[model samples]
Target chain A: MDARPTGFSRVTAPQFDPVVRLRDFTRSFGDNTIISGLDLDIAPGEFVILLGRSGSGKTTLLRTLAGLDPTPGQNVIVPASRAVVFQDARLLPWKKVWRNVALGLRQGDVRQRAEDALREVGLGHRLDAWPLTLSGGEAQRVALARALVREPSLLLLDEPFAALDALTRLRMHELVLSLWTRHRPAVMMVTHDVDEAIALADRVVLLDHGRIVLQERIEAPRGERGQVARALRSRLLGALGGQVLEGPSPAEIIALHAGGLA
Target chain B: MAISHRISASLGSARWLSPLLFLLAWEAGSRSGLIPERTLAAPSKVLSTLLDMAVSGELADNLWVSFLRIVIGLAIGVTVGAVLALVAGLSRQGEVAVDPLMQIKRTIPTLALTPLFIVWFGIGETPKIALIAFASIFPVYLNLYSGIRGVDLRLLEGARSFGLSCAEQILHVILPGALPSLLVGLRYSLSVAILVLVVAEQINASAGLGYLINNARDFMRTDIIVVCLMIYAVLGLAADALVRAIENRALVWRPSIVAQ
Candidate 1:
C-alpha cells in the first residue's frame, strides 16, 4: 500500500496529433471504481506500455480506447479507426489466415491487402491455413496482420504475447517494433512484464488501483541496453511494490548469446 | 493423411463382413426350413422382391412420391426453423417473442398432433406433408438456436473492435460460427422428416412406401415389407452420410483429420 512514484511526470503536450485524449475518465462497477478521474494523452506514433497487476485495470483502459467498452460519458476521444490485438490472438477458428486478416475491410482488393499485411508479418505463405492449425506465434502474427491491415491510426495491444513461449515472445517484440516503425500508429500495449515495458515502450506507465501511479518516459531509445533503461525498470518495478525478477537480467542474457555466437 | 487413407481402405473391406455373415446365416436357415418364410422373409427373397418391384416400376413410383414429400417437407421445415432461430437468436425482442413459442412447440412431439392435422387438413397429401413438416421443425430450431446463441462472445467483440457493422458481424462471424450446428440440425430434421413421413403415410395413404407396406401386410408378403424397411434404413443412412459429406466440405477449416 506504500508504493512510491519516482522520476514521474504527468505527461503534457507530449508530441504531435494526440490520437488519444482521456479527460477525467472514471469507470465504476457497482460500488467499486476500477479507474478514477484519469487523464492521459498519447502523441502520434508513440509506443506507450501500461504495466500493472492482474486487477490493475490496464486492460480496462485499453478496451475502452478500442471502443469495445463504453466510455464514461464523452470524456474519451479516440479515432474512429482503431484495432486491438487481444492476449489470446482472437482469430476466428472457422476462417483462413487471409480471411481473418480481411475480416472488416470495406475496400476492394481486400485479399491483396491482407496478403500484403501477412507478407509484412512473415505469414504470406500461410494465407489459406486455418487459425486452429497455426502455432501460437503464427496465430498472433495473423492477429497482428488483421489489426494492421485496417491501417488504424491507433493500435491497442492487450498482452498479445502472454501465451507464447519465451523465444516466441522475444521474436514478437522485435516483429511488433518493426511493424510499429513501419506503420507509425500510436500504440498502447498492456503487460505485467517490466522488462518488456522497457524493451519496447517509448514511455512506461504503471497503474495500481486503476490510476497512473508512475509515468516514466524512456529517454533511452527502443532496444536500448544502457543504464537509464535498467534504472527505469528497477524504479518501475519498485513502484509496483518491489517486484523482483527470479531470472537472469536482459544484459546477461544478451552477453551470453553474444559470447556463444562469437 | 496417407496412413489414414490406407487404414480406412482396409477397414472398408472389413465393413461388409458382418452384413455378409448375417445374410449367409439367413440363407442357410431358409434352406433348412428352420426360418418360416411367412414369419420373416430370407434376405435373398427380399432382394428378389425388391428387383421384381423395381422392374414393374411400382417401387420407383412409390419411392418418388415419398421422396417428394420428404424433400418438400424438409424445405419448409428448414426455412421456418432457420427464420425462427434467427429471429430469436439475434435480437432481445425477437427472442422474447419467438423463443418461448418454439420451446413449447419443441416439447410437443409432432406425431402427437397428427390427428389434429388430419381433422384440419383432411386425409390427403396436405395433411401428410404437414405432419412431416411439423416433425422437421423442432430439431432444426433447437440446434440452430443453441448454435446461434453459443457463438463466442469474444469473436463478436473482436469483430466489433475491428469495425464490422452489426449485419457484417452476423454474416462474417455469427452465421459461419453457427453453421456446424445448423448442419447438425438439418441432419436431425431429415431423420425426423423421414420418421414422420412413415407414420403419416401409415395412418391414411393411397400411394407411397407406407401404402405399399400396408398392402403387403394384408397379403402377408413379408418379402415386400422387408424390402420397404431396408429402403427406409438406406435412406436414413444416406441422409446422415450426405450431412457428413457437407460437413467435410464446409467445415474443412477445422483442424481434424476427417475435416481435412
Candidate 2:
C-alpha cells in the first residue's frame, strides 16, 4: 500500500454552547486560502443564511461545517449527523423517487417516514416513479425530502433553490420555512441572492474574500412574509453595497426601490 | 411527444431489414458467381447445412460445448474483474496498485497468450476457457472502475451529510450509480467471450462452432463454415439484446435524452 496521508481523521470535540460553532477557522487549497481566520456561532435552532459572490467561499464554508472536509482545530463542532441539499439536486439516476427521498432512512419504519417526507414535499404520487421522470422542481423537492427525512440536527443548503424558476423558488422557500418550523433544525444556507438570505435567515452573514465582512440580525416574525420580506430586502441590498449614483444614503436606496424608483 | 411511436416503428423496420438485406446480398452475390460458388456458398445452402447439422445433433453438441466454455469462462472473469474493480475503485492504494497493471494487461492481445495458455494448461477445455476469461475480464474491469469512481461528489457528500456510514453510502449510492456502466461492460464482455471462443476453436478444438468451422475447413465444406459464422453472429446479437433488456429495466430512473 502507498503511504500517502489521508485527511479522514475523526475528531470528537466537546459539546459546548452552540449546536454548531466555528472558531478561528483557516482552510486553503495549495496556497489559495478559501477561508482564513473565520469565527461564527449558531444557536441551536437559528436559521443562518450565508451570502457571498460566486467565488466568495460560501460553499466551502458550508462544506466544512458539514464535516465534508478537514478544517483547523476548534473550527467546527458539527453534531453527530447533518444533512445537505445541493444546488443540482443530485438524485441517484437508478433509484426510484421514493428511494431517493428515503436515502438516509434505516430499515422497518423508514418506509412510512419516506412516504411522509414525500407527501410533505408534495411528491407523494411520485414515490414509485423513476427519478429521471421528475421535473426539476420535483427533483429539488425530492432532494429536500431526502435531507429532511434524516431529521438531522443541522441542515446545510448550498444554493439549493438557485436552479429553480421564480415561482418554484418562492413556493420552495415557503416549504423550507414550514419544514424549519416543524423540525426546528439549525439551517446554514449559502446563496448569492440577498433577498433570499433576508427572507429565510434569522441572521445574515456577508462573506467577501473568504472572510466575514458584515453580519446583521433580522428581528421579524416568520409568518409575515410580505412586510418582513420587503423590509429585509431593503436591508440586505444595503449590506451588499448596492449602487449609489447620486450618493443616496443607505436608507434612501431602500426607499428608492420600495417607492418603485430605479 | 408523439414521435416515440414513430421512432420505435422506424427502428423496428431497420432491425429486420438490415439482416434481410445482408442475407439477400450474400445469396445473390454467391449465386450470381461474383464469388466462386464452392468457395463462398449461398445463404440457402448454408441454411440447409445448418438444418442437417441440427438434425444430426452436431450443431447442438458443438453449441453445448462452446456455451459451456463461455459460461464458465465468463463467470470466472466477471467475478474476478468485479472484485478487482470494486477494490481498486474504493481504495486509493488499491487503485494505485491495480490501475497500472490493468492498463498494461488491457493492451496485450488475448490471442497472443493462447500459446502460453496451451503450454501451461494444455490443449484442452482449460486453455480455451482461460483465453476466454482473459479476453472478457478487462472490459468489465475498465467500465466498472470508471463508473464507480465517476459518481458525483455532491451526491457522495449528501450521503455523508445524512450520517450514512461508508457501507450505507456504497449500497445506496455507489452501486446503483455504477449499474448502467456495469451492464455495458457485461455486454462487451459477452462479445469478447464469443470472439475468443471462435479463435480458440480455430486453433485447437474438437467441439463447438469453432470446431465446426475447423472441420468444414479441413473437409473443404465452405457451406458449413458460412453457417457456423452466421450462428456465431446470431448468438452474439442475442446475448447483447438480453443484456440491453436487463439494463433498460435496471436504469428505469435514467430518462431518455429528450426528458433531460
Candidate 3:
C-alpha cells in the first residue's frame, strides 16, 4: 500500500495514488476547444476545488472527471463509481425528497441511509415533501444528498450551490465540510466564487484557458473565511493573467509542501 | 361585488337550465301547431320513443354492441399505438421508418376508408373495429413521440452520472418524464375511438346507436333519431369522463392545474 499522509502528518503532502489522471486531455465542441493538452491529477480524499470564470472549462474538467461527458479514447482508467451533483438540483420531479436522495441506492434499507443523508444535510424534516415544493436551497441540498448517498470514490459538484442565497450557501459549505470530514472521498467542485474555492478546498486549483494556471495550498483552518477570501482573490486574479505564477507547474505547488512553503 | 357574484352563479346554472328551456319550448311549439308534428316532433314524443326502444331491449342491445366495439377497438388501438410510440420515441431508426406513415394515416379521414375496409374485411366487426383503431392510433403516436423528444436532457444526464444503464434510464426517467404527454394522447385517442365507432356502425350494423339513427332517418322517425343522437352525445361524454378519471389517478404526482 502507498504510504498515506494523515492527520497533522499530512503536512508532508500525502503520496496519493492519482485517482483521476488526465494526460494531454483535449476536448472540443465543433470548432471551440474547451480543453487542450490539459494534464490534471486528483488524489483520493483530497478536496480539490476548481476555480474559473464561466466557459473557462472548470465545469467541463469536473464533468470529465465524473465521466458524465464523452472523452477521447486515451483518457481511460477513469473511476468506475462516480456521483455528480449538477448546478440545478435536477431532482426527479415525480419522486419525493427521500426517494430522490436514495435514487441510486437501488434497494435494501435505503430508507435509513437516505434519512441519515438528509439529516446530515439538515433536510430530514423535508424527506416526504414534493421536490417542486422545495426552495432552491432545499432542492440543491437534496441534489447533494443524492450524490453523497452513492458513497462514490469520486464526488463531482458542478456549481451545486451557485443558485443559493448567501446564508444558505454558507450553511451548505459547512454541511459539505462536515460530510467530507466523515466520508473523505475525492471531491472536485467547480465554482466561480473564488472565496468558496478557498474556504472549502485543501488545495485550490485555478483553471484559465483550459489549463491549470496556479494551484495554492490553503493551509489555514476552514473557518477563516476572511483570510481565505483574501488568499483566493489574490491567487484567482493571478491565474486570470494566464502567466505562470512564480514560474512553476501544479507539481511544484504540491512539492512546495515539503519546502515549508505556504 | 356581492351582486356580481349572484349574477355569476345564475349564469353558471344557466348551462343546464338553458337546454331544458329549449326542450320545453320545442314541445310547446309542436303542441301549438307552430310547426307540423311529423316534421318536428315534441321532446315528449322523443322521450316516449326512447322509453319504448329501451323496453323492447332494442336500445340496450344497440348500446351493448356500441360499448363492446368501443372497448375492443380502444384496447387494440391504445396498446399498439403506445408500444409503437415508445419505440418511435426511443429509437431514431424506428421514428424514421414509422413517422411519415403515421403522418399520412392521420390525414386520411376514417369515414372515407369505410368502403375500402368493407371490401377488405367484409361488413363484419373486423372492419368496424379496424376503422376505430386506425382512427385512434395516430393521435396517441404523435403526442407520445413529441413528449419523449421533449424530455429534459439534464435529467438524463443526472441518471447517466449515477451509472444507470439504457433500459433503467428509460424505465426510471424517460417514461415518467413523457407520461403527461402520453396521457394527453390517451384522451385524444379515446375521443377518436368513439367518433370512428359511430361512423363505422352506420353501415350494415345489425344493432347499434348508429344503426338506429340510420333506420330512423330512412323511416323519417325524427323522434327516434333525436333519441339516438342523445345517446351518442351521452356516450361521448361518459368516455371522456372515464379517461379523465384514469389520467388523474395515474398522474397523482402532478399538481392540479387550475384553469383561469
Candidate 4:
C-alpha cells in the first residue's frame, strides 16, 4: 500500500491497493539499455494509458509488466491473474474461435464460459469460426474475448486497435469502455496516439527516453467534450513536441463515431 | 479467340479424351505392323494381360506383397522420423545431438547404400525392408524438423503470456502450427516409400511386382511389363490424390480453403 516518492509517477491515492508496482526497474540487452530506473503502479480497476514514441521504451515496459520479458527479482511486481491482447490479435489460426478464448482455462464448463465471453464481445455467432476467416476487427474482438475470459486482475493491451480502420477503431473504443466498466480489471494500454490515450485513460503517463516525463490525471469523466478535450490535446501535443491543432478534432471524432453507428 | 475457346471447351468436357485417343492410335499402329509388339505392347494387349493376371490371382498376390512392404517400411520410417524430429525440435541439447546427423543423412543418397544394405542384411526381405525404411526416413525427418523449427516465436510468446504450460504449448500451439509441413513430409515420405519398394522388390525377390516384372522380361511378355508399369504410375497418382484429400479436410482453416 506504500506509494513510494518516485520522480513523476508518484501515485497520490493511498486508499486503493495497486495490483502492479514497479520500483527502480532497469532492463538491458547486452550493450543496449532499453529501460532504466522506472517506477510505476496501477491500482485496481484503474485504466492507465502509456503514451510514448517508438523508441521511448513503452513496449519494453509493457512486455516487462506482461511477463513476456523476465523482470530481475523483486523490482517488478504483478498479479498472477493477468492477460495480454497483442497488436496482431495472435489467435491460433487452427483453433476455432471459442476454443481460442477458452485456452488454458481449467475450470467449470469451459465451452460455456467461452460462449459467454464471445457473447459479451458481440461475437456469439463466430463461436466456431476459424481465426483466419475473421475480419481484422472481428479477430481483435475475439482477442478481447480471449483476454476477458481469463478473469484477469490485470489486462494489458498493446495497441489492440492500431491496425483497425478509423470506424472500427471507434467501435473498439466503445466496446472496450463497456467491457472495462463491466469487468473492472486494472488496464494498461500502450499507444502513440494522443487522442486515443485521452479518450480511454483515467491517467495518462508519458515516457521520453526510458523514464516518465509527465503524468496527467484526467479528473473529468471519460470522453471529455469541447474545451477539456481541446486543452488536453494541447497539453499532450506539447509533451510530444508538436504544436497544437495538428491532429483530428473532437467534433471530427464524434462525426467518425456517428459514422460508425450508421 | 473463338477457336481457342472451342478447343478449351472440348478439353474441359472430356477429361479422358487424350488418353483414349492415344490408346486408339497405339492399337491401330500395332495392327498395321507399324509398331513391333515385342518392343511396346499395344494398349489393348496390355489391358488383356492385366485382366489375365487379375483373374489368375498373380496380380493380387504380387500387389499384396508390395503393399505390405510399403506399409511396414512407412510405419517404421514415419515413426522414427517423427520421434527424432520431436526430440531435436523440442530441446537445444537434443538439436545439437540429433540435427547434424540428420543433415548428414539428408545430403547422402539413400540409394547409394543399397549395396551396403545387401551385404549387411543379406538379400532377403530384411534387406529390401531395410532399404525401403532407410529411403523413407529423410523426407519425413527433414520436412517435419524444418516445420517444427519454423513455428512462429511470437505465437509461442502469446501462449506463454496466457500461462500455457510447456507440454500444453506443444500440444495446442507447436504441433498445430507445424501440421501443414508435417503433412507435406508425410506426402513426400509416402511417395518415397513406393519408389524404394519398387527398388527393394528388384533385389532377388521371390514374390512382388518386381518378381513379376523380371519373369515378364525373361519371357519377353511386353504386355505384362506395360501392365506393371501402368500399375506403378496409377499407384503414384493415387498416393498423391490421397494426400490432397487429407490436406483439403485438415487445412480447412487456411484462408484459401476457407473461401471454398
Candidate 5:
C-alpha cells in the first residue's frame, strides 16, 4: 500500500442513531434457509457496500433491510421511509419520464419537483420522453431521480450500475457520490465489482453462506484510490476464498471469478 | 428523418392504388356484361341508388335507427362487461362466480340464442337491442379480464414501495396498464355489435339498414341491397377509426405509436 494519507480522519462527528438494525434475524424458503441469525447495524449517512459471490444471500440481506421480506418475532428495524433501485431500471413503460419520477408523490408542485429531480440527474431534456425511448443509462438515471425525489431516509441500491458500460459506470459512481453527499441518506449498495466497492463505500462487507464473513473500512480519499486499490483487491479476493493470479489487473480477477461459474 | 418522410409519402399513395384499381375494374366488368348489373350492381348504379335514397330521406331514417340501436346496445354491453371483469379480476370469489358462466356464454353462439331472445323479449326493439348486447359482451369481458390479470406484479411492488394506497394503485397503475387491451376489446365488440344488429333487424323490424335490405330483396332491388351493405361497411370502419383515435390519445406514452 502507498504511504499517502487515508481519509479516515475526515469523519470527525460521532454517529449515534442507527438507520437500520437487525438482531437474530432468520429467513427461509421452505426447507432451505437463506439468512440465519444475521446481526447488523447501519448508522445515519453511512455509505456501506456489500460484496459476495453469487447465491451468498446478498440480495436476501438487502431485501430484508428494505423490509420487503419480513421475519416475524425477529428484531428487524428499518426506517419508515426508504427507496430501492433494482438491477433493472424497473421504470413503468406506460408513463412518461417525469410522471414516472412523480409517481406516488401526493402533495405540492409535483410536476415542478419531478422536473427539478430530473434536472439533478442530468435528464431535464427528457421530461416528456417515453421510458421505452431512453437508452439504458438514461433510464437508470431516471430511476435514480425517482428514488431521489422521495428523499427517503434510507436508499438501497441493488447493483444499480451492474448493467452499465465502464465509462457510464464510472460516471454513475461519481453521480451517486455527489447525490449521496448532497442528500446525506444512509446508503447500502450491493455490488459484484471489488474496485467499485472500494471506490464508493466508506465500509466494505463480505458475505458468505448466509453470514457476514469479513468487514473492513476503506480509508482512502477519492483521489488517492489508485494508490491503494491493488492492496484492497487482494484482501477482498482472499476473503472471498480466491487467490489473486499473475498478469491481470484486479478487474480481471473479478471477471475471471465471475467467468469460472459458467 | 428525411428518409422516413419519403417512405411514408410513397406508402400513403400506395394505399389508394389498389382500391382505385378495383373500383375501375368493377365498373368496367359491369359495363362489359361480364358481371350482370342484376347480380352485383355496378358501382355507378349503387352510388346513384345511394344518392336517390338520401334525397328521399329513406337512407337517413334507416341509418339513424340502426345507429341508435348500436349505441344503446354497445353502451349497456360494455358497461356490464367492464364491471364484471373488474369484479372477477380483483377477487378470487368473483372470478369463480363469473368466469365459468362467461365461458359457457362464450361457447354458445349469439345467433343461436336469437330465436330464444325474440320469444322472451318479443319482436320489438327490445329483442333486437338485447341480441346486440348479448353478442358484444364476451369480447369485452375476456380481453379486459386478461388485461387486468396480466398487469406486471413487479410494477405493483414498486407502487407499494412508493406508499400508494390500494385504490390509488388500481386507478393509476392497473387501469392505465390495461387501457390498451381494453381498447382492443372495444374494437372487437363494436364489430360484433354491428354483425348482431344486422341479423336482429332482419327479424321483423320496422326500420334499420337490415329492414331496408330485406325490403330490397323482396323487390329484387340489388342496388338497394348493395347500398345498405356499403352503409354497414362504412359504419364499421367509422367505429374502428373512432376507437383508434381514442387509443392514440390515451396511450400517448407508448413509444411505438408516438412518432414525431
Candidate 6:
C-alpha cells in the first residue's frame, strides 16, 4: 500500500487485489483524441469517484471501462462480469420493475434474486410497477437493484444521482454507500458534484482533457467524515480550478446524513 | 353562458343523432317515391334483404369466403413484410440489398397490377389472394422498417453493457421498442387488405360479397347491393376496432394511454 502525505492517513484495506487495470489505454474519434495513454487501477471493493467538467471524457472513460465502446484499446483488463447504472435509470419502459431487475440473469431463480435485490433497495413493493410510474428516486433505486442483482465483480455508475432532487440524492448516496458496503463490488462512479465525490469515494480522481490531473485518497472514517472533510474539500476545489470556501458545516453534514438514513 | 353550454352539449350528442336523422330521411324519401328505390334502396329495404340472405345462409357463405381470403393474404403479407423489415433494419448490407427494390415496388401501385396478376395466375384464388397480399405488404414493410430503425441507440447501448447477445437484444429491446409502430403498420395493412380484397373480388370471383354485389347489379337488386356495401363498411369498422383493442393492451405501459 502507498503511504499518504502528512495529515492524511491511508484507509485502504490490505490483501485486496486490483479488479480493474488499464495501462496505456488510448481512444480517439476521427482525429480528435479523447482519452490518450491513460492508466488506472481499482482494487476489489474500493469505491472510486471520477470528477471532471463537461466534455472532459468522463462518460467516455466510463463507457470504455464498461466495454460498451467497440474501438480496440491497449492493455485494458476489465472484470469479465460488470454492470452499469446510468444517469438516467434506463429501465426498459416496457418491462415491469421486477423484470428489469431480473434482466441479464439466465439461471438460478431469477425472480427470487430480483425480489431479494429490490427488497434490499427498499423497493419490494414496486415489483410489478411500471418504470414510468415510479418517482425519479424510486426508479434509480430500482436501477441500483438491477445492477446489484447481477452480483457483478465491477460496478460502473455514470452520474447516477445527478438527475435527482437534493433530498433524494442524499438518500441515494446513503443507499449506494450501504449497498456498496454490503455487496463489496469494486465501484467507479462519474460525477460533476464535488461534495458527492467527497462524501462517497475512497479515492477521488480528477480528469482534465481526457487525462487524470490529480488523485486523492479519502482517509476519513465513514461516520467520522467531518474532521478531514474541510481540508479535503479545499484540495479538491483547487484541483478543479475553483477557489475553496469554508465548505458545508458539520451540522449540515449531520443533518443530511440523518435525513438520508431516515 | 348556460344556454351556450346546453347547445354544445346537444352538439356533442349530434354525432350519432345526425346519422339516425339521415336514415330516417332516406326511409321517408324512398316510401314517398322521391328517392326512386330502383336507383337506391331504402335502409329498411337493405336490412330486409340482409335478413333474407342471412336466413338462406348465402351471406354467411360469402362472408366466410371473403374472411378466409383476407386471413391468408394478410398472413403472407405480414410475415414477408416483417422478415424483410427486420433484415433491412438490422444490417447495412440488407438495407442496401432490399430497400431500393422495395422502394420501387411501393411506387408501382399494387391495385394496378391486378390485370397483370390475372394474366399470370389466370383468374384463380391464387391471383385474388396474391393481389390482396401485394397491397398489404407495403404498409407493413414501410412502418415496420422505420420502427425497427428508430429504436433508441441508448437502450441498445444499455442492453449491450449488460452483455445481451444479438438475438436477445432484438427480442427484448428492439421488438418492444418498435411495437407501437408495428401496430400502426398492422392497422394500415389491414385496411389495405380489405380495400384490395374489394377490388380483387369485384374483378372476378365465384363467391364473395363483391360477387353478390355484381350479380345484383345485373338484376337491378339495389337492396342486395346496399346490404353488401353495409357489410363491407362493418368489416372495416370491426378490423379497426380489433387493432385498437390490441394497441390498448400491448401499449399499456405508455404514459399517454395510461393517463387516459
Tell me, by TM-score, which candidate is best.
Answer: 6
Q: What's the count of clashing pairs in each model shown?
A: 0, 0, 0, 0, 0, 0
**Better candidate by lDDT, 2 or 5:** 5
Q: What is the lDDT of residue A74 in candidate 4?
A: 41
The interface root-mean-square deviation of each model, in the order shown, is 0.8, 1.5, 1.2, 0.7, 1.4, 0.7
Return the candidate ranking by TM-score, descending.
Answer: 6, 4, 1, 3, 5, 2
In candidate 3, residue B249 scores what lDDT? 78
10 residues in a row with least lDDT, candidate 5 chain B: B251-260
Q: What would the per-residue lDDT of candidate 4 be over residues A64-141, giving only the tens digit for each residue?
A: 889998754546768889999999999999999999999999999999999999999999999999998899999999
In terms of lDDT, model 5 sits at 0.86
- Show the lowest summed lDDT stretch of 10 residues, model 4 chain A: A1-10
Residue A228 of model 2 has an lDDT of 56
TM-score of candidate 3 chain B vs. the reference: 0.90
TM value for model 2: 0.84
Off by over 4 Å in 3: A1-15, A241-262, B1-13
Ranking by lDDT: 6, 4, 1, 5, 2, 3
lDDT of 5 by residue, A22-91 (tens): 7777888999988787888888999999999998899999888777776566677788889988888878
For model 1, the stretches where C-alpha displacement exceeds 4 angstroms are A1-16, A243-248, A252-262, B1-21, B257-260
Superior candidate under TM-score, 3 versus 4: 4
RMSD, every candidate, angstroms: 6.3, 7.0, 7.1, 4.2, 8.3, 5.3
Q: Give the proportion of true interface contacts each model preserves, from 0 to 1.
A: 0.94, 0.94, 0.63, 0.83, 0.60, 0.71
Residues B1-260 of candidate 5 have per-residue lDDT tens digits of 99999998897879788898899999999999999866888899999999999999999999999999999999999999999899898889999999999999999999999889978999999999898888888888999999999998878777777778999889878888888889999999999999999889999988999999999898888999999988999999999999999988988777664355
How well does candidate 4 reproduce the true complex, by DockQ?
Answer: 0.74
Off by over 4 Å in 6: A1-16, A71-73, A246-251, A258-262, B1-13, B256-260
Q: Best to worst by DockQ, what's the order? A: 1, 4, 6, 3, 2, 5
Per-prediction DockQ comes to: 0.77, 0.59, 0.65, 0.74, 0.47, 0.73
A94-180: candidate 1 lDDT, tens digit per residue: 888899999988788999999999999999899998999999999999999999998899999999999999888878888888899
For candidate 3, the per-residue lDDT at A39 reads 74
